[model samples]
Target: MSNVLAIAGVTRILKDMLNDALVFGNVDQVMGTDFAVTAQPPDRIVSDNPDTQTPHLNLFLHRVTPNAALRNADLPTRSGDGALQMRPTLALDLHYILTAVAAEELHAEVLLGYAMQLFHEMPVVPRESIRTSLSAAELAGLGSGLPDFGTGPLSPAELADQIEMLKITPVALSMDDMSKMWTALQASYRTTVAYDVSVVLIERALPVRPTLPVLTRGGLRDPETGRDPGVAAEPHLATSVPSLLSVAAQDQHPVMRLGGRVVLTGTGLDTGDAQVRFREAGTDVSLLLVPEAPARPDRLVVQLPGPAALPGGSSLAGTPQDPASWRVGAYEIEVILTDSEARTAATNRLPLALAPAISATAVAGGLARR
Candidate 1:
């Protein structure tokens, strides 16, 4: 839950930690010279005048990789139109190489040993240590050795407030990898050790669209009946389960048009008080149609309402002036069966393409009537 500055904050904290340890642990006093801690690249550490260069410990961030455990934790965080649906976080792991430099013999090795020991003794960086190391000179002591009196432009205090603690562990590099890394740097190899810092979470600060809590599990109960018809117990059987094979127009046309009859071919379709349900795709609108009398077990016929009301009663109808209730698009067709005892079950849903009926046509500079 930190900001983008967390990565730089980590490097700054490590540099300060080493600087403090060297000064307070009396390593510089025993060596009779000051030991400097830097976060510069290994190639940049090389200087022409080695005698003037003091004993130094450099922390170079070599590579950054995604944390495997929480890499995809924030998937599907955006909507179809690319609007923010939820807050997204980036989890990362940082790899660094700690190298020591000195002109005198054995000084570089001693510095490297101290740096490794400091990390080993404190495997996990404490929140208090981070806050203190990144604090300003007025808040901390003047000896606090960081750019701009400890609080740089990176705003590293955000790192201390993160939820996950930073862990430092040693990484074993193969000789081939070491050789390639040095060759890439093009600098003389010094006493170096690799360390891994993990779980730096950088989150985006943006408004998210949150859904309202559900007030009811299903539809509201009837005022008089005190029961919800939306609840039903559907039967699941290994054999003789109601399923739809195909739904096509009466003339075997692939598309169904207004004022046309469609035949439903399936098994176990005939049941108590059965009706065909049409659900428009991508919408909650539904239309129900009653089957013809003397229903067949494996087939049923339903007539779509025309511009005028049909002879037999139908659930819905469309007119030339008003066709709002009927939309020409794809729909899901399913058979709903309800018994006398109010027990209801539905068959599998299949796709149904509803086509618009063209009764008249008008073109530019001309008009035609059908």
Candidate 2:
């Protein structure tokens, strides 16, 4: 990006661009060293003062407006070092009036035409092409560029290497507006055109630390629910969890039998991204019962896995008796939201029983009932 250039620097850059236009436009002979630049109130152009009665292009700054998008953004250093200093860069849109002056109509029209052509062909000024200062000898060769005659020091251009390309767009003014403008300037209107130069940025000079990137994210959260990480037992708080209302089979009989679809109804279950847990009662062998299906706020349609399909089946768990495995047993149903960084809360444990209606086996007594 380019370093901050003051208003004077901007004026210098514009003058150079216009000067180059006349030189390379092959109209050097026509617009010779006689070309002039006057103050905004170009009364000199019509004055008896010989300095004003020359072939010239008058550049006047008409307006300056702030760039809206660049306004009010936080500074990079504000977040660092706990500093409240907000050193924001000011982006400005510059409007300029380029008017051609000459006693002859053709000469004035030709100069204005060349200026328009130059800006049209090179709408954006590149970094390398910007110049801070041009020597008297160089100006003499260009047929333009007046030497600094004011008592003040010479203001040099400093807009080189700015990140944004200086874009020039033509302004369309209404007839009444244009007339009022010329009258307001108190100068006779000549062949003139308006151009807007954008994104002239001036950065703050305050001492600030460089903006740093976020290195890490804190805490663990279940991305699905934006809730706390699932835990083995309880929630972080007792009051915040989804309160389990009821879990019932969707069938007409409404029996919570294994392998049947059941709807878990709850109060706080509406929080997006939660889980319904069917934990084996009286054991630490808890498995995530909620399927990878979508979660709802008030209810969840889930299919209970059969005993054989229960997480870590009894047969595979141990030889004879796997106390933790699901079988003909009682379980606790819970709705949980694990917002790790925030909190982990689960509804009160609700009791659920898994039962087989009837089982027959050929035993010593032909059938076994136990």
Candidate 3:
């Protein structure tokens, strides 16, 4: 996704493309003078002294609307618990009024015709052209660089690298529409053509909620009965802190791996804010992990830190998980529940055996038969 500079980047690319075409097409030789391409308001282009204004084309972004195809593509960006699931994007279609400014008769018409032809010939802006336009410090000798306009070098590659290639389409503006727009801008109506540059996506790289890998599907299968034992509910006997009945790896292995997930079956285990505690056996040092959403009162799923870093592993709480925090040993697992009153209570600790995952590269030699 692109950043906030995407809009300005698109405008810059269009202005530069037109300016280049004019230069290569040698419109100056045909018109017998210098021509300019600019990105400015229509009102700002016109002046009291008409003779001083040069024959030029001005790109003015008159309106911005959402792209109909991708407007709602990134919906449900956040989970029910208000955690960000994905980065939201703003897809936009830029409506521009390309106005030709020339006091002499037929000069504006010539410039407008040439600009329209250029847009028609080249419908889509090439990705490399976009990169070159945004990176350059100037456009068409008009000094219409990006917004900052020469403070320092800008990194607008995201705009160029966006998935949707910017396409130029002619917009047929009715006579009333043109009259209303020019009147609103308070500028004299010149030979103007409307165009739409579509699908400029702008999104920010915000941290999102990390999810766990799928362990077991459906439920644990009974060894003797060969039937899955789905989740069951048990009545809470009394009002007290949450208590754990059993702790097992979701994969049903004898020992849990560093990066594996564990399921805690207990009573009164769920709350709005629930964290699973993994304490090193016989030590006060421990780590707390927030459970995934869709809270359940009888079950809690928690992921254990891996032996090495994983994607977005540090984004859980903005703290990197150190491999030293977890090792091949016994850990006492418990669930901490926080109530609406801001009080917290932890459940009884249950034992879990965590083991180190062996790698083929780490082995000194191939295994030999005993």
Candidate 4:
């Protein structure tokens, strides 16, 4: 068989051993009552030399179960083997161990020693000792065919160092070790049926934000008054604003609430018609609002609800209030602005704060004076 195939076979045997170990030794520990084990075969193999008789294989072991109890257990309690089970909650731990054994320094030495033993006809020489005695071209030629002493470039020490750099420690298993582990496992489980095992490790990806940009408002004039909207608008006025902001986010159907005070301001904007809404954003939350008619040239201000433990910070445009000190859970404010039609031009969204209570207070305080 080809060296690559041999490596694959070795991995398969090792995985089977692991599964048997779990099943027989500590069926309760490894899989609990409801879990199932699956085997994923080697996807690739790497050899130290092109003509080397042995190579290393990569394998995956996967455990599947619908048991919520098992899923919720801590890492230490979740392994397939009861006594031997390490913390199984973290999938990364399995990957680390596997990678360490498969491609790491420990395995590299073991594989090299094993390959030399297997290929009795080929001369076995340390890579470093050979490198010192031979030139690059000579070493290349030596590595091409039957191994010769003093012809390969890298010394054993240097090769070992390179293996260390690769962070290959002690994860994968050899065929013999695989057999031993499997024997122990099968005996423990008392199962004669063949089983497949596959192990997968995955990292959760971050959520993506919407591609659409926030809407903008351009300068426009009042047709009835024929005055610059800026001049005619009111300042520091409260107007009722809608609570929801992004329509796309709303599709998630997040629970909404009036999180804090909602207000609108501009030359002519008042506090009556403005409304505000809140929705969940991952672990945190966001607020959106729309101001009433009688739009202003100046920007509008929206504040997040503050908590008592205000982190020594406040909103940009409003007065900071201690969230804990306030007896009321809900507060409302409003702003009146010209309808979208009345304004010569404007964008859809008005900026709002998604900060903590203290930060929101700091922000509101800063913006209130502007």
Point out where model 1 deviates above 4 Å: 136-154, 211-370
Q: What is the per-residue lDDT of model 2 for residues 263-360, given as tens digits with 9 covering 90 to 100?
A: 78776675545666777677765545553467666677766554443255445454212323445667787776766345567778777666654545
Evaluation by TM-score, superior candidate among 1 and 3: 3
User: How close to the true structure is residue 195 of candidate 3, measured as C-alpha lDDT?
Assistant: 96
lDDT of 1: 0.80
Models sorted by lDDT, best on top: 1, 3, 2, 4
Worst 10 residues of 4 by lDDT: 160-169
Name the candidate, 1 or 4, with the larger lDDT value: 1
Clashing pairs in 1: none
List clashing residue pairs in candidate 2.
2-161, 2-162, 225-273, 227-338, 227-339, 228-338, 228-339, 228-340, 236-344, 270-297
For model 2, state the Cα shift of residue 175 in Å: 1.5
- The full ranking of all candidates by TM-score, starting with the best, is 3, 1, 2, 4
lDDT of 4 by residue, 149-184 (tens): 223432221222111111112334556755665464
Cα shift from native, residue 99, model 2 (Å): 0.4
Each model's Cα RMSD: 13.3, 13.8, 22.7, 23.3
How far residue 174's Cα lies from its native spot in candidate 3, in Å, is 0.6
TM-score of each: 0.54, 0.53, 0.55, 0.19
- Can you tell me which runs of candidate 2 are displaced by over 4 Å? 1-4, 30-33, 37-40, 49-52, 75-86, 131-158, 209-305, 308-370
lDDT of 4 at 123: 26
What TM-score quantifies how close candidate 3 is to the native fold? Answer: 0.55
